[model samples]
Target: MDIVSVALKRYSTKAFDATKKLTAGEAEQLKTLLQYSPSSTNSQPWHFIVASTDEGKARVAKAASGTYVFNERKILDASHVVVFCAKTAMDDAGCSAWWIRKRPMAVSPPRTQKPLTTRVALSLPICTAKS
Candidate 1:
């Protein structure tokens, strides 16, 4: 479909049918699509958590309930829920190396090695594991 059609159809869903679950294949496809989603600077600073099983969802539900108690059920019953997390700080975790490798201008001069600007996200995700 067209972008406009997709945009128009997109809306936040409040309720999900617990009985209806996404197949493994469908879940995989969703993950692949999210991975390829465009982001600023191609930093790919985002991490995702996919909860497809009851146990997995429960873990996510616990986190959601701590804050958004009403919205927790949406996560509990959804076929699959993806939690997107953005990295807050760049450290020796190879984030600087990654940026320097990807962007030539990010490198500092030989005379003076300067730290690269770090990107920070507002909130951290409770789940850090990838699907």
Candidate 2:
């Protein structure tokens, strides 16, 4: 399908035709598309977890505020679900730690947004002082 059609048709599909299943190749294609999705400063902070099991999907739905609508029965019947998570806080880089430690959030002036420039600058792979 064209990008526009795909974008328009791609709703938050809670319900799926239970009889359908994605082939290995089709699943790989979906992963490829997901990999190209946008990220801040090329951080690619998102992680994808694919669950095809009804129990696993149910657990995820329960963990995500209980109203996520995984539909255990549909999960058992349909294909797969992808979970995305950000990986920002899990980094140990010196610059990343610097940004986190130096960013005056709660008590600072509103113009502390300069820290965002610092973040984007650090996020770039330019290798300023140390990684």
Location of the lowest summed lDDT over 10 successive residues in candidate 1: 120-129
State the lDDT of candidate 2 residue by residue for 1-131, as single tens digits: 48998898776766688678899999898899988887555555567888766776676656554574446555555687887875544333644544555453634326745544354455554324322
Q: lDDT per residue, candidate 1, 27-127, as tens digits?
A: 88999999899766566777999888899988988887556899888988998988888875545445545556566775364544333322311121221
Per-candidate RMSD vs. true structure? 7.3, 9.9
Residue pairs with clashing backbones, model 2: none
Candidate 1 clash pair list: none
- The list of candidate 1 runs beyond 4 A from truth reads 100-131
User: Quick one: RMSD of model 1?
Assistant: 7.3
Which residue window of length 10 is worst by lDDT in model 2? 122-131
